[model samples]
Target chain A: MRGITIGQYYQADSPLHLLDPRVKLLCTLAYIIILFFADNPYAYGLATIFAFAMVMISTVPVRMILRGMRAVLFLALITVLFNLFLTPGDVLVEFWIFTITRQGAQTAAMMALRLFLLVLASSVMTLTTTPNKLTDALERGMRPLKIFRVPVHEIAMMMSIALRFIPILSEETEKIMNAQMARGAAFDEGNVLKRAKSLIPLLVPLFVSSFRRAGDLALAMEARCYHGGKGRTRLHPLRYATRDVIAYLVFAAFLAGMIVVIRLF
Target chain B: MKLILDHVTHIYDPHTPHARTALRDVSLQIGEGSFIGLIGHTGSGKSTLIQHLNGLLKPTEGSVYADGKDIADAEYNRRALRGRVGLVFQYPEHQLFEADVFKDVCFGPKNLGLTQKETELRAYEALQQVGLEPEVYDQSPFDLSGGQKRRVAIAGVLAMRPEVLILDEPTAGLDPGGSREILSLIASLQKERGMTVILVSHSMEDVAAYADRIIVMNGGGVTMDGTPAEVFAQADALKEIGLSVPAATEVCRRLYAAGIPVRPDVTTAEEACEEICGCFLR
Candidate 1:
């Protein structure tokens, strides 16, 4: 559980870290969409540089960034493999009704690079922004949906609570696992069926307690007179600043560079 | 069973940015049938140290020896070791998950592969030992009161019939009366059944009142280890580590300074009372 590097906000003082999370959220989406349009070798190279520069600008350790890549490695590998053998063209190697084509190799490499770059660009955002700020941005970004009676505030509140509970629930899980292990509950020793059976001892309590915690949390919130989003004020409302404007300008410059490189080169 | 931590060192999330040295090169020996109170401030490696005793955690650098065998070794039967050296985690009630209280207690011995009759017998005895009534056995563990749930959780470990029972803050989050009840129950288990107990707690008086030996931990190492009187004697040093002498021991100190000819190292209220009585009688 500790090895998981995705969605963990790394604390660092950098321009990217200081940028408004809504801007970061929107820019990340734009970058992914832009990546899909980057076709030629030089365009891919520029996109790779953009992803690398984002990681550097965020001041998040490259090692931690690479650790996040490991999580999507299987997905990347599958994409590469499918493109490698399934995309038919001029055959480069053939065996047992399977043919590796010249275009297939190129497509496979591009697909791998694109998948990795996609994850890298997103993780840079996640690693820079704290979960609270991310959810705050999410709530603000979805503010328009309140017109449709979408329960925007409730959804955001739930997201924030869920984000808060991940680490807590994981810690609880470890304690529960240790507790059961001390009872001679062999979690690792059993066959697939038996191991799954063993988890009942661990999971049932966790589920029960999580619900209990959620109930308690609701009571605590209500005790403070939380009556949904109506007439509610944020502790720290989101606002655009000079740095956010500079970030938007930087993003626009990057987009122009991306479009120019892709269109001209 | 004799338990020995041979220069154990535990590092959590080693070689990572979040790495922490939870336990340093600390060594200790716990003999059979001894009630040893392991006291320390929060995050002072108290929890990390007890986890090593039963092979629940492998030391990053050292070995945990139980009955002259290295538990971390590939040859050892860790399953059996865990059964004999049961560790009840802090807030153990969070681990209870069976359909009923009786079945939850039986989970431990059942894991040990005891016969159905034996498991049920141990569960019944364990529930009785924790002072729970027969009527609650059929009810879900979740339906019980906080103190009752805690009892059921403790009974879960006790049902395993471990020779060495290690409870991490057994009385935490309980009312004072509930705390006293649980502590007395533990004391009785040590006295009546001769079970070796290593109680991990933050309460100074709890240890002084019950433990034969007190082990003080600070910054992932054993800062002090001695009898209750010997450890309490270093009250100033204990306070430096964010711990304090028990309330009674502090009162005893004040009494000594106030020109009373009472023992300076008095730990428990009962002990201080005896000393004051003796001084007055003299």
Candidate 2:
């Protein structure tokens, strides 16, 4: 069950990990936006190359990135299949009432490639940046929203805390499920309704424990004099370095190249 | 039924990046109707070993034989084995989710396919065994005190009428009085019912007072196995592995170190007191 690696950070001492998280987050956003404009074959090729470069430089195992892709593989396949059957264009193949058109197949491939690259690019951000650093970068990047009375720090902290609890709650759920299983609770043997009913024993304890943990955490935060990020000081303030500037410039060049490629093609 | 683990090994998340060897090439025999105390520091594979007793976890290598039948065999009935070997996990009460204590206790026997009457009878008998009063039967288990809820949870397992009972830190997070009550209840159940009881605990004092045989686990293997007296005699060796003997045994050791005529093997407070008194009288 621990194989769920979405939003999980992989620890490594690569250039990606050393880059400022703010820069990485912005670059990820830019990369994703660039994917939408990557309509032609050349643009798609450039996007794929950029993603591969990012993954290679991050030094995270290709296996880990592909594991994250598993979650979206079905969606990508569905999108491709739908476009192959649904779109109108010059027909390439005909089978039983369905026509595979040239435009439809191209559109399907492009959509699938877009989705795959989008997932891979976003995963690269989460894989390299720790949750704490991600939150810090988010808060720093959203500081402009303070003019609209947005609680940027609080929002970022809440997001980070939620992300932090995902694995913990999952582990707790596994423990509870195992405990119930030891008592002859058959989780897998029943019909759909029965299987869900079997989960009552698992879910009740999990909810109770989660509430208790949240209360305890709140009390702990209060004890530590936490007051909603008001006048709060950070031990490691987000700082932009020379490498971060170079990374931003490189991504900007990539974005300009993507736009030029799309226009030329 | 006698339980034999022959060179059992277990690995968690095998072949993955997070793969961990929780137990390795560990073999032991648990005779029927024996009260065995499993003692170990945290992460010493004590939990993993007990889970193997009933086939809750299959050994990665070797085999587990219950009553001379290999449980790891493909045709083995694991559900029946689970019914025979009941496990009460740490904070077993957390697993309780029934509307009332009585219904919660009835879960196991019901799962065992017992008739309504037989299930109720087993639940009542098990509740009595755990010393929970009749009045709390109709109340929600969540409303009970920590100790009471834990007893109810144990009653749930006991209702299965297991031949071999395994408890993992059953007294953990309880007050001293509550811990004593739970341990004594387990002792009585083992004695009166002749049930094979395997208690996994961190408290050396509790095991010293109650268990006839003690097994020490360290670094995914059985490091020491003997009677409590024999095991506690090698206090220095146990200490080297980050485990300690009972307080009474520690006191006896100190007195023996001071050149007093007291046996360092004394494990209980009563035994220590008697030995010190006898030394003074002599």
Candidate 3:
């Protein structure tokens, strides 16, 4: 349960940690978008260098980044397998009815690399930016959408509350599970049907308690006169620093390199 | 019910920047029918230590033995061990879920693979043991009052008929009357069933009133282990670790320092009252 890192911010005194969350958010978005456009080795190489440099600058442990990747590794493997066995291209190897194609191998490699880089690039942002900062950035970033009656502030408030609840809910889950387990509720050793049935004791109370918590939180927020984002002010408002500007320049250079590689490829 | 921890060391999030040594080479033994109060400051490893007693957590270093068998062994069944050492976490009422109190109580015995007949019988016995009125057993657990919900939660664990029961602040979030009632119920259960009860609490008076033995934890190690009177006698040391001596013991200590004849080891109000009356009365 502890292994699931929802609030991914790894506290550290480093450049990436100091970088403005707005910059980190935009950079991650840009990085992920550029990752999809990178079709060749040169483009991927430039992306890799950018990703690793951000990772190194973030100072979040390498193992943690890789740990976050483990969940997506299976999806990547499935993509590889699907491309390997099914992609129509020049045949590299032929068996009775199966054919391994050259294009399929290349596509699979690219897809796997893309998946790896996608998670790596995004984790660098999440691992450095606190949930508050990220949510704050999200709210501010989408402020322009308020013009279209998007209710950006309300959406962000709910999101921040949810992100805040994840760790709390997870800790509560562990407590309930342990409490139930102590009473001989075998959550691990059971068939699918039996396992789902075993969750009844754990889930019921969890839902009731979480709803109570939510109601309490609402009361607290209302007690403080929390109305939506009309005139509400944050304790720490987002602002771009020189370090953030410098980080943007570095990203710009990477993007230019990628554009060149895209043109060449 | 001979539960022993042999130099157990538990480190949470080990090898990470957030790595914390919650238990550091601490060892203790719990004999049958012993009501041991495990007291500690908030971060002093009391919770971590109790989790080891039931195999909810394996020690990063060292061993926990229940009935002379290593609970951490690959072949050892943790489910059965958990059944034997029932742990009631703080605010246990939060774990109650069944539509009715009786059904909720039966959850534990049912988990033990008991037949419906046996499970229902154990549930009835457990509810009675916790002093819940039979009429309330038919009501939904959620509909019950806070104290009733707490009793139902404890009854859930008791339905399993554990040899050793560890309650982490069973009376937390209760009124004074509710707290005393719950503690006395646990005290009586320990006396009647002869099951080892480890009460993890922050209250000095609660321990002094009920526990025969007190084990004090500080900074992830067992700093003091003795009878309540013996442990509470060191007022300075207990205060230094952010734990208090019982209120009665503290008053007696003040009296002793004031050149009075009151003994320094008076742990309970009754003892201090008797001593004071005997000293002053003709």
Candidate 4:
């Protein structure tokens, strides 16, 4: 149950996944800025089309995008409802005490669209790039923080290892749960108190196993000469390619178009 | 304590996209006080089948009855059920978490909400049963050797005072001496407590030497159920499932093949020696 997909990464051979992570990350920031500045239906529509085009280029299955959408549907609904009812504007409809205003509806729709695009674009990046490569890029980008003693390399390496082990630990948990259950530890039959009590079997074992794994992994890392990521040379160095330059150019065009659409219309 | 599973089927993550059938209409009965050896290759549903015996899993469309009581019944307190049916998991040492050995072994009984004094007594008795020193009670479980950690984990379950003690690969990854020690401990425990012990193992020699009855599982179904002598006789079938006959069984078979009139029921080195001598005398 713990091996939940926290980030959306659609595995595709599309142009989106092929783009450098730094470029994609910067583009995502720019996209969010453009989305926030989008005030009218036309500007929001342009941003939506741009996001849709990116999704198409990434070649991620539409169903996966919808699945991702379903996971955060509740949060999206809350955001939309908060904007619609809380924002004071020209009232278009009224029910009981809650009033839906014209401008509020427009604001709600634009906000929802912005969030959806933001998540999708980020997912596209994650889906295409391995976590190791992504972290490498992040560490390289954050190298300027070395002057401030930020330990960017260490932080990135930690994140990479954590991502790598999430699935492994999840599988271990399932095995342990199965093992305990086989001995008559039914996890499902309980009141709230009983349920919490039931968790003792799972939690105790899980913690023990994780700690044991942590010890083993630490020993393994030490044995392999992993010494705090200091002076480590990479086999695949990060470099900005032609594709990355073109990706940035496209992002700039999208940003400019979004501004023009929002300001002119 | 006749544990009967009636046409039991189990699917993990049922109705999800990752739905998988771990067991398929597998029916078997483990007779009370019988040391039943459950043998199978990996993912053969041996693990899944045992879970049903203690009510860890509810079959998708069947029932499991322990001592003629439906284990899946809503009225059955599962925690209480676990107290009766002890399960020692594979690499059980990895389950140790309490800072001290005493508290670690007492986890199950404490979970049962036993009184402080009673819990202490059971924990001590269980530790002694596993051949651990009372002085080691205050020692960190993490500080112990791999075998000791396993013993402490087993003692934890033993503190529950279970009627049926199920072990999943109890001797897994242990050295030869450690394996022998654990097997002997289990044998003595069964004899002393008359506990219905279900040992899941991939080692045919261990099962042959110890188990009175052996249940062979393959692809989520009970392929064979018989006495060790009865099952080992079908050496071809056992080998087909990537399992081998007991060493002595193999020796006797070879002796028989070499035109020696040795008795075929022998499953240990001593038994094989005695039977071969008897054949020569005859």
Candidate 5:
């Protein structure tokens, strides 16, 4: 159960970790948007090169990034298979009800590549940026939302808290599952409905404990004079360094290059 | 049932970057119907060892034999073995999920494939064994106090009618009164039912008071296995491993160091009181 790595920040000292989280977050968003716009092979190749360079400069292991790919592998495969079989073009191979077309194969491969790159690029942002810093940056970036009374700080706090509790809740679930299993509760043995029913024994305790933990956290926060984000100060205020500006310029250049490549191709 | 661990070794997340050896090449034998106390500090593998008793975890190396049969064998029915050897994990109440206490207690026997009537009867007997009243059995388990909820959780395991009962820190997070009550209840259950009881605890006093045999673990290996008196006699050795003898045993050790003719093996408060009284009378 411990193999889960999604949304987990990998701690490493590199330019990526040093960049301002807000800049990184915006750059990631731009990268994902550019991925959809890059349709041709040359544009896709340029985008892939840019992603690979970012990953190398970040000093995060390629294997770690690939591990994050496991989460989206099924979705990538489904998109590829659907496009391969369903899209119409010059038929390269024909079967009873399925046709392997030239355009279909190219589209499937390109779609799979787009999906993979999107996941990888977003994972880079999450891997290098600490949740606390990410939330701080998010709260700062959304300050304009205060004009609409959106409670930006509260939303950031909720997101950060949810991220922090993911691992804790997973560990609790494993413990409860093992405890129930010791009582001869076969979670994997039953049919679909039976499996769903077995999960009740696991979920009820998890909800109860999570609520208890939430209560304790609230009390602790209040003890420290936490009364929402009003007039709250940060220990490490989000600041843009020299490297962060360089990173933003590089990301903007990469996006412009991808757009130019797509237009020319 | 007689349980034997033959050079058991357990490694968590094996061949991974986060791999850890939780249990070393440790071998031990637990006879049938013996009340054994397994004591260790937080990471000393006491919890890992007990999980192997009922096949909740298979040893990474070596074999665990129950009733002279290797449970790790492919043909062994682990489900039936789990029912025969119930394991109550630490803070077991966290596993309770039924609408009411009675249904929660009935879960174990129902899983064991007992009929509805048999399941209810076993649940009633188990709840009664844990000193829970019948009226509270109809209430939501979440409505009960912490101690009561824990008892209901224990009754859930007890309903399986395990031949060997293993409780990991059963009295953890309980008040003094509650701890004492639960300890006494376990003692009575062991005596009355003649079931093999293995208690994993951190409190030296509780183990000293109730356990006939004490197994001390340190650094994923068994360091000491003997009667309470013999184990507590090595107070300095246990202290070196971040464990302490019972308060009464510590007192006896102090008296012995002060040139008084007191037995250092005295473990319980009652025994220390009698020894000190005898010394004063002399």
Candidate 6:
């Protein structure tokens, strides 16, 4: 089903999948920071190589990462085009009113590479780590925010459930669409307004059913004595291993290199 | 005319990382006006196979001829094909979204670009067919009970006037009495319309009681296809695929196994008892 495919965290015994999710989350943030600080062409190329190496090491199929990238290709291309056309810089080649500048090209390329690397790194974390584990790390890491009474645990729990249901909801959406189609509702054809209006049959039922499922799930959880964040113990306890230490050290090294490359080069 | 699938194969999202083949080289001809029950294990390609009937899914490497037209043709009118083959999905209540029963049931006819008068008329007729009263037409569908909601969903599909009605797990999550009510409504509707009714279910007893033909699917393949009696007679084969014959048929098989003079072909409990009594000399 389409629902199951979207959130399929590859279950593997690889080091990337086995590292503490908390460590992975921190490293992903640091990785994005390093990506942003990389300024020159050589630095961006190096970052790309590092990302590809990590993608391989994660043990996720290259085909899978490419599929995920395909979903965001449109946005990446748009960002690149916008930056290329809009960003003001010194002109290298003039064409009518527009100018193709070396600085603009460099900026646009860096921006494109930055966005691509950011998505790829984040996807690497998501693909290797289950949502449940991600939420567990988030809840535990955000415990410091309890001083402000932000309901961080509850927010993380809600996020975990939402992540869990993305596929479920997609499948439900497909069914609703099919039911509407059987009723002669044409989704693929028609003008924008007509197509928008055609979705009423699908959307109404989907919203109602989502609420119904949420209500039922809430009731079931209540019946099972699921009071929030009181004494909840996880079945799998997260532990920092030697790989986590090596990964964090590598991230620190990458961050230093990015700063040196941007400032000096 | 019969709907024929010749060596049909369907792969969901081909070339994607999660690409999966839901059906494989499945070939079958479902005769017109025949009540065929499609039984399958979960993820056995039953849903995938039925979705092809209406062109909701185009086969990756095969053809489905509906009313003698190849649905896989690039120029095929998919919307019109959908009108001819109504697919009532599992948990039909999940598709109920209109403000009232009348508007909901009329949704289908209206989509077909029928006149307002015709849509209203067809909606009323569909409600009547499903045993829903005209008085409840103005009431919000959300206010109805689970069984009523399901029937309303079914009526919405029937309002399209589909010649072939395919129901997927219609009795799921219903109590025994509610299941009977829904099944009887389906049977009566099929009889009145003389429509080709394809019931996809996991319950052996349901298929045994109503379907004239049974098709069993397991692990993305059609494992068995025959009349209900014939299919249920292959108890061992069904069991091998994580399915079973009807309880009555199993009882008959056990009785025959124990040297009792009862036919193994008896599928329903009533038929089993009559056969057992017939074997005993008065």
Please tell me which predicted candidate would have the highest DockQ against the true structure.
Answer: 1
Which one wins on TM-score? 2
Q: What is the DockQ of each candidate?
A: 0.80, 0.64, 0.78, 0.35, 0.78, 0.71
Specify the CAPRI tier of model 1: high
Quantify all predictions' global Cα lDDT against the true fold.
0.90, 0.91, 0.90, 0.82, 0.91, 0.86
- lDDT of model 1, residue B36: 94
**What is the lDDT for B131 in model 2?**
98
How much lDDT does candidate 3 score? 0.90
**lDDT pick, better of 4 and 5:** 5
**Model 1 misplacement above 4 A:** A86-96, A100-103, A260-265
- Angstrom error at residue B107, model 3: 1.3
Residues B1-282 of candidate 4 have per-residue lDDT tens digits of 577889999998887666899999987777768898999999999888877776767899799887788888899776677888888888674466677999877777876878999989999999999999777889998788878878888898899899889998988888999988998999999999999999999998899888999999998888999989999999998899888888898999999989889977677788998998898888
- For candidate 4, the docking band is acceptable
Clashing residue pairs, candidate 6?
Answer: none
Interface RMSD for every prediction, one decimal? Answer: 1.0, 1.3, 1.1, 3.4, 0.9, 1.2
Worst lDDT run of 10 residues, candidate 6 chain A, spans A1-10
Cα lDDT tens digits, model 2, A1-265, are: 6765647899999999999999998889988887887889899999999999999999999988998898899999899999999999899999999999999999999999999999999998999999889889999999999999999988998998898898999888887877777778888887899989888888888988898889999999999889997788989988889999999999989999999999998
Q: Taking the candidates one at a time, how many backbone clashes does each contain?
A: 0, 0, 0, 1, 0, 0
TM-score of each: 0.94, 0.96, 0.93, 0.86, 0.95, 0.89
Residue-level lDDT of model 5, residues B5-72, one tens digit each, is 99999999999767999999989998888899999999999989999999989999999999999999
lDDT score at residue A47, model 1, on the 0-100 scale: 84
Candidate 2 error regions (>4 Å): A94-96
Per-residue lDDT over B38-98 for candidate 3, one digit per residue giving the tens place of the 0 to 100 score: 9998999999999999998999999999889999999999888888899898876557888
| CA shift of B252, model 4, Å | 2.3
- What's the ranking of the predictions by TM-score, best on top? 2, 5, 1, 3, 6, 4
Model 6 over residues B1-282: C-alpha lDDT tens digits? 468998999998898666999999999998878899999989999999999888888889889998788988889887777777888888766677888899989988888888999989888888999998777889999998878888998999898898999998999988999999999899988898899999999999999999999999987779899999889878998898899899999988988999988898988879988988888953
Model 3, DockQ value? 0.78
- Candidate 4 lDDT, tens digit per residue, A137-239? 7888899999999999899988988888888778777776765553344577759898887777677767777777889989999999989868899888877
